[model samples]
Target: MRTTPRRLLAAMAALTTALLASACGGGDDGGGRAASGELTMMVPLFGTAPDPKGEVHQAVEKVVGKKLKITWVPNAEYGDKTNVVLASDDIPQVMVVQGKTAAFVQAAQAGAFWELTDKLDRYPNLKAKSEQAELNASINGKVFGIYRVRPLLRSAVLYRKDWLDRLGLKVPETVDELYEVAKAFTEKDPDGNGEKDTYGLIIPKWPTPVFCSASPYNVIETWFGAPNCYGDRGGRLVPAFDTEEFYTANRWLKKMVDEGLVNPDFATLDSGKWNDPFVQGKGGIIIDVNVRATQLYGLLKEQDPDGYGDKLAMGGNLKRSDGQKFSYPFDGYNGFLAVSKQSVRTEAELDEVLKALDRLATKEGQTLLANGIEGRNFKLENGYDVPIDDDDPAVKTINNDVDFAFVQLGTWATIGMGVYESMPTSEAERENLRLRKELAELDLQTAVHNPALPIVSPTYVSRGATLDPIVSDARVKYLAGEITEEQLRAEVKRWYDSGGAQVVAEITDLRAELGAGGN
Candidate 1:
């Protein structure tokens, strides 16, 4: 059970009672408290790995003095499931959604969630978090949802430093340099096996190239001498797939293949290979998420402590002509929570839920989220959070059995930066601090944040969801020498022809409004 404060827990139990009586008929806009034992909560399964429990959440339940009874929902199938549930108008007392933020917006508009803007102060915990995080609760001026609190980071290239040094190469800081390193790494075995068993790098798109426009590679296309892919010239938000940067990156990738740099089978590179190759000491470089670097370090320390400690290097973005560091686009706003109009029939109920979510957004929440049941799951030593007796077989068993993935740490909202949310164990904290510093020191030549990231729209965010697969397939075939770049170009034209133009228009419009197209 979660260790929510006793008072907050009581309030939740009280809210559940309110949910029972007013849950029917779309809840009233006034204050409400369902009758106890009536409300159910739904949340996307927090852990994608084998572990199923969240200790902080358990603490929340414990604090509430009752089981919230949260059912696990998969993010992949969220849209379909949400639609089905919404169609039936049968929802849990609390629903923490993931995936498809636009749908959330639409749902909230249709009176799906409870509004708490007018009743935020009652839950001091939630209110405090919201204020500290500067979390946005309103969209286009309407209070719609509360964002899931996580910090922001500039993503970068992850490489095996040992391999680079072995190959006598410095970290590549430009597209051209990236190519050169890939080639040399390809030709010269960095693994010391003396066999051509490894590829220079492994940024997979297999069987096709896959990139997130909000990613530095896609959004900062212009820095690579390509058009900026984030928005249309008109300042309207557009999809990255429809942008010229998409084609440019592909072309660059194709050239790498032609030059015997990147693996031709890259398009079909499996996730295991993408991560495992580097972990096992095969591939050298990867454009990875900010979290994975730390996660990889953890995995390495556990599996091959010495090798992990000695082998890896977290690199920054490749620089542009002017030596600007670039970053890929990532969703800035994590999802939000809103009150259902039906529930606010009273201010107190609205206050209750708002308070709960808000509390989950700040430091107290950060501590609980990352560390889990303070004295129980962990011990604080010198202001650092550490798992209890981590070396103990019992501790290991419990950690493996539970409290693994719940440690979603390092959000700008939580610590204002990655430097602050590191592991509390002196050792763990050292690794995190070092890694965080590595990220910070990455000379970002061009801080090209994903252009379309701010706009809340379907056409932009979802455009690549379908086309990315297609492009990936086509690019893979071409890179493996199966298809021509000309063919790839034609396909890109097809993309532009099919809804790409519209996306461009949207981007242009968005940009014009923000006065963002000057560069």
Candidate 2:
């Protein structure tokens, strides 16, 4: 019954494969001629896919000196598709691997990707990447890809400035002050609606583990003097959850939940809807990246052009009882652009692809990636590029289209490529950007790093999926009062018995080999 469709699909697939081989200029030794024809790339799409004929695409093609053939996979299906692609021999020439996952590591080790550690030094822009970002992107000290730069530190407390102003409360500087402010926001009707319908904090079901920098719990734990993910405890790396500060922070959060200051459905709330409650006046706090404050303010301005004036604000990490501050730091990269050996097939082909990427990292290329074709998407005024309003559908379609495919191909944040040319269109946007910069600087002064992030563990790589859930599940249970402190400790012990100890031992050895200080 299925033979007709199956045969037809198989014939179509073969035709596509043959076409790609012809266009890619199949297998020739590195010589006078560089790799010819269109370069193929696979990248995840956040929203609508960019048009191949768009001005942005054409500009990028001109800069890179190659016609690009890109496959736009949706974000939700990327992980599964990446796994399948890694297992096959038909990978794209350039692929955006989202993380250094077990499959990616194994594939890289097996020669599926070109080893790029020593090779990067040949390209000035690639070599100029931040040391930490490169380290975090490596697999057991070997680099197989060029990392996409993200901030080393970006987390902050995003809160309702208007609520704090109305309640006569200052931005919280200490843990105790944060708690009291939360209580006030919950008890007092800061919205002036004469109804106690709003809570203090809006915690969603966080997507990552509790130890990740993105987790609000990790933010509070680090502020309470716990390590970032893993800490040097007694000359050995240990999970942050094992520390007393972690429990203290959790107990404080639990108290907030018990007091009804936090959302009751936080454990099950969708992260996609995290900002909805804040926008709807049902919550007053969200601990996230600094840019979220600007985004929330922008949303509020759009909703109530006259009423919502400076409704959101951001601040650095809180000080502890002893007046010591600690800040959670990002992993310093989003993902990497890996050149596949299968599609490239030769040194010359690899060089051609890397050269295109090198051009993409330059100031001119970075400017194009970030702002798009200047006169079309933005206009220069007062020595800054002010983005034109994208209200026009035609303008919006062509704006930032190339970025969807190649934005992650540059080391912009880490190497500081291009000019800081963007000027906010509004006074409110300007104020928000200024405030974010100030708070981010404060956070950087007390950044706490995870010593284990760069070090690879065989046990963790093989059993991390199993090992991580043991701690994360217990943590969620502990927070919800489903388990007591004693039970939580038991779960931690269980984790140690289940490959965590091996992971710790490996990390300790690796750190020692690298001569990294325990602190």
Candidate 3:
């Protein structure tokens, strides 16, 4: 169940290696067409594959008017399995591929998967998805798959509002003010336990500059004027660590560590356990994904059914000392869905599969996929579908089945909020939903787009898996005061010597090739 970030990273690396080792092959020869009204698919499963005879499966088949044969691959092994399937010419008619990976790009370029650009316009719901997501999934400026859309940016500072009120402190509005708030939460005993045990902030272990919902490094760097990953410098693209802003951000984090304002074990802390201190009332603030607020609120209520439910709050887009506020935007996709030419074998079969997927993009399809059978899993109330017998074994089984059945297809933010509003029986969940929506909207106003997101460099494709850890280790060392600014710069030089410079040059050429300018 993705027990740890380190393990997950290791698994992904293994999968990438397996996929890269697989031999490239020709596209499907249009030989195995499913009988009329039947389709086969392979999708990643978060848990065990659900029973095909389950009510959720029946509901989906009834809605889409098709009989289905699906292969449920565990998410950790999906990439490797997909690679083996493609190499053996045993791929499903439809499959989910990690679009950003080098293996998928290689396979796509080799004509292993069908390109969907021309077919997209024929499906209204599929075409309605975010264009930027489609762009993010593109290979050499060509769209090859239908992207699964998610929020573009949703990072925020989640704090204990009740504690803030008791301490007579206001929500932080700037970087400096945020530090001050953290200091106060540490020394003021805001929890009123009359002990010096509470921390103002909980900094979780972050392995990279990638925006992790549970980590503060990315948000802090953005506030300090560092770019998401690459920044525009004199009309050329450069890594954020090469700039002075990255140094300043590292210095600020070091100061926080020296002051004991953040968790001391942050460099080694497990991200899954990041919320433990907050839930136990030993910390007051966390920089995390918007959805975590709801999860945290639920856990807090379960721990203290009568109290502490309404204490949590979320805030975001805090201004910097320079009067700028920005949040890094994401690629806005879960992954992507691709069709295998070998499996479908004909344009007519592809169209039938596309039509079925198009149905999944509709409101009815979304509702079914997200909530399961209405009367069985939920009931209508005041225009909302309140869950029914959520803890029942049958209901739980069906709900789990939905995750493996199909893709969410389109914007899940709105549909998710609706589900949240309908299911949470207490005010805390509702408040979490409200705060999530608020922060999401606030982030939209000042989201910073990464110019390098859609451009894949050959150097990065070959050396990134090795170099990223080096950079991350150096950053953590710098923030922990184990390395000086000069030493950090030395590490960056080593990075360049070890292929980062080549990556930069390739990305620059790619940007020019695509006519994308440095912002």
On lDDT, the leading prediction is: 2
Count backbone overlaps in model 2.
0
The alpha-carbon lDDT assigned to residue 471 of candidate 2 equals: 72
Every candidate's CA RMSD: 8.1, 6.7, 4.0
Indicate the TM-score of model 2: 0.88
Tens digits of lDDT, candidate 2, 1-519: 000001112133343444344334434432223377577888887667778887777787888888888888988888777766765546788888888765666567666678898898998877835777687777766788888787778888878888999999888898898898889889999989999988898888876553343578878889999888888998988888889998898899889988989988888899999999899888998988877765687689888887666687677788998898888878777788898776777787788888988987887887777667687877878766666777877678766463454454555632122345467656766777777778777788788877777677766766665677677778778888899989998999999998888878898898888777644
Model 3: residues with Cα > 4 Å off, grouped in runs: 1-31, 207-215, 403-421
In terms of TM-score, the best-performing candidate is 3
Q: Which ten residues in a row have the lowest lDDT in candidate 3?
A: 1-10
List where candidate 2 sits over 4 angstroms from the true fold.
1-34, 209-213, 345-349, 383-385, 389-394, 413-425
- Which 10-residue span in candidate 1 carries the lowest summed lDDT? 1-10
Q: Write the per-residue lDDT of candidate 1 for residues 337-405, one digit (tens) a residue.
A: 444545344445554554455545556555554444466656666665555777866456445423333
Provide the TM-score for each candidate, comma-separated. 0.74, 0.88, 0.90
**How big is the RMSD of model 3?**
4.0
Comparing 1 and 2 on TM-score, the stronger one = 2
Q: What is the lDDT of residue 159 in candidate 3?
A: 90
Candidate ordering by lDDT (highest first): 2, 3, 1
